[model samples]
Target chain A: MTLQIAGGLLIIAATTLIGWDFSARGARRVRDLTELKKSLILLKSQIDYSIYTLPQAFSHISPRVAAPFDEFYAKLAKDVEGGADAASAWVSAVHSLKNSNLDKTDLENFAILGMSLGAMDSGVQINSIDMVITNIDDSLKRLLAENPKNSRMYRGLGIVAGLLITIVLI
Target chain B: MDITVVFQIAAVGILVAVLNQVLKGAGRDDQATMTTLAGLIVVLFWIISYVSDLFGTVQSLFQL
Candidate 1:
């Protein structure tokens, strides 16, 4: 009967629609997780490079200030809970810094950038992690510009970004 | 005013909520948020057309 055939078609259409919706959602989630894994790796590598460079800068400062920097770095390493990567470690470090003697405004800014690194805005051009790295690189460049002694801080920034770029492309 | 349509709308709402929660748990918060928004818009469109029809009928009977 025509009525029976129409009913069957309607049922099929409804089922297909629901199935498609679920599949689309699942695909999006999978894609997001894959992207996050890559980003986390990129972040880890970048942080390690930064940590390596920090020592050179630390040496440039007076010995009295070295204790504070050491304390800061040690606290950071502890907070990340062995993230096994630079980005996670950096965020963990930043969190510890916030709880310590760092200026409140600076802490807030750092936290905002850290949160943005993981924010998923479709309209955002750069991933949050990249943006944070860029900000840090830019800040270093500016500080080095004002005082040449700080140039060592920016040495490995490009390498870090390049590493992330390769990981993303791969 | 039909009970059948009300039930269908309710079903759509429940489906949307379940879909949103599943997507969120999978760590696709962006897509999960979008799906909930999109589902709401689709359901609103469906209900709006029926409400418009009802209003049209009421207007004609009341001459307003």
Candidate 2:
């Protein structure tokens, strides 16, 4: 009886953790998006005010943004310095990201933004950044609205599923 | 054949019902339907042996 109880508890704990992780994913995405927005704004100001080249701008911005994004910009700076053009460098840097919460669509937007980064005049570059910012804003709004309900559902499902499995096995 | 089987079935029913409501309230009606079907299948699996046993008893009693 003790063994069965312990095993059941283990199953419940594992499923609950899985559900919690799933719920946290939305919040992580929101944090990543917000950080990306801030970093892009900083990059915009860097472009507008300084005569820094793209690589220099990226290196400067790298240390200032949050984690994962800081790594992203650092990689971007490294790739650009290694003789890759801005667009390809951007794409490669984005591809190198690990454990990021941003989904495929978010990554795609960033890739599109990269294509215009250093290949265009300052006005075009700023316009592309603004467009991505708008997209992030929309996604953030949607996530914020859906996250609470989705998280609750996942948590409940996890515990209930654990119980069902335990009961079946017992 | 055991009382525990009945209790397990009841527990599964309650849990599945809660899960279905949760999925539905989260606007995932498709998942709610799927969960309900899954629960039904699980219950059927549990009782299928007993059902077969009942049929065997009936057949023997009829001497057919």
Residues B43-63 of candidate 2 have per-residue lDDT tens digits of: 999999999999999999999
Query: Candidate 2, B53: how far from true, in Å?
Result: 1.7
lDDT of 1 by residue, A82-157 (tens): 4334345546655655434334443454555444432334223135445545554454444334332212212222
Off by over 4 Å in 2: none
TM-score of each: 0.28, 0.94
CA lDDT of every candidate: 0.46, 0.90
- Which runs of model 1 end up more than 4 angstroms from their true locations? A1-170
The lDDT of model 2 is 0.90
Minimal lDDT window, size 10, model 2 chain A: A92-101
| Candidate 2 C-alpha lDDT tens digits along A71-157 | 999988899899999998888888876468889999988889988988899999989999999998999999999999988988887
Candidate 1's TM-score: 0.28
- The pairs that clash in candidate 2 are none
